[model samples]
Target: MKITVLSDTHMPRMSKEWPAPLLQDIQDSDLIFHAGDWSDISVYEELTSMGKVHGVTGNTDLTMIRGILPEQTIIEAGGKRFGLVHGHHGKGSTEANAIAAFSGEQVDCIIFGHSHIPLLKQDGKCLLFNPGSPTDKRRQPQYSHGVITIDGDIHAEHVFYDSKS
Candidate 1:
């Protein structure tokens, strides 16, 4: 399965649409995961139009989004279980907070977003991934997103670009 991951889109507040490269990635993906901060339901609607979309509701998300999506959940794909969360606790280190979100869960990977920083790492038995912000990079050097291909084991990578235009 080819899974395309995105987070912190903050659309309309970020961009009206995805960049060409990211759009192509979404078009070619088998599954899509949006970590959160989507801002508008249209972002979710647009992604769903492209393919299957599984997502969480962020701290910044409006009532409609929060109502429709869970703050955290688990999804199974390609026989691997993934923990999804917006990863915001409003206190200390974002990464630490993210890891803590899935502390007692039995997920193969924890996928989250909040700081708009791309990350992929392993801690103990599970993998942690933050796809960053394809639309809102914040102070980051480049816009980015993540792709995970699962055959036997999961192979993940980040595709970084200099511009959204």
Candidate 2:
């Protein structure tokens, strides 16, 4: 399975449409994960039109978004358990909060977004991934998103680019 992960799009607020470079990845993905802060329902609608999307609602998400999406959830993909969260609920750094979100759960990976910083590392037996904002890179040097491919084993990587246009 091929999964595309992203967060903090803040769409329409960031751009009227998906970034041109990111579009190809999104289109090629078998599944999509949006960690949150979409800011507009159209972003969700558009992603769904392209493929399956599993997402959480961020602290900044509109009420309509919060009403439909959960704050956090776990999904099973390619025989691996993935814990997903927007990472704004607890009293700590976003990374810490995300890890805590599934403290008692048995997840192979924990995916989150809130700070718009791309990170991919191993935390014991689990993988931690944050696919930074393609539209809102913040202090990062480049716009980025993530791709996770699962065959016999799982592998994840960031796709960075210089432009969001």
Candidate 3:
């Protein structure tokens, strides 16, 4: 399975649409994981039009979005357990908060977003991934997202670009 991960889109506010390259990536992916701060339900609608989307609600999401999405969730894909969160709940730093969200759960990977910073690391037996913001790279050098490929083992990497337009 090929999964495209992204978050902090903050859309129509960030951009009216996905960047050309990002859009292509989304179209080509087998699944999509949006960690949140979508800000509008239209973003959900737009993404769903392209493919399956598993997402959590961010602190900045509209009420309707919050009503439809959970603050955190876990899904099984390609025999791997993925814990997804917006990383705004609980205490401490965003990364800490995300880890706390699934503290007692057995997840192969913890995927989160809140700070709009791309991250890829190993947390013991689990993988930690934050795909950053393709539309809102607040202070990062470039816009970015992540791709995770699952066959027998899982592998992930970021795809960075110079522009969001």
Cα error, candidate 3, residue 59 (Å): 0.8
> Which 10-residue span in candidate 1 carries the lowest summed lDDT?
89-98
**Per-candidate TM vs. native?**
0.96, 0.98, 0.98
Q: Write one digit per residue (lDDT tens) for candidate 3, span 36-88.
A: 99999999999999999999999999999999999999999999999999998
Candidate 1 to truth, TM: 0.96
Whole-model lDDT, candidate 3?
0.93
Clashes of each: 0, 0, 0
Q: Roughly what TM-score does model 3 have, to 2 decimal places? A: 0.98
Instruction: Count backbone overlaps in model 2.
Output: 0
Off by over 4 Å in 1: none
| Residue 56 alpha-carbon offset, candidate 3, angstroms | 0.6
Candidate number that wins on lDDT, 1 or 3: 3
Ranking, lDDT, top scorer first: 3, 2, 1
By TM-score, the better pick of 1 and 2 is 2
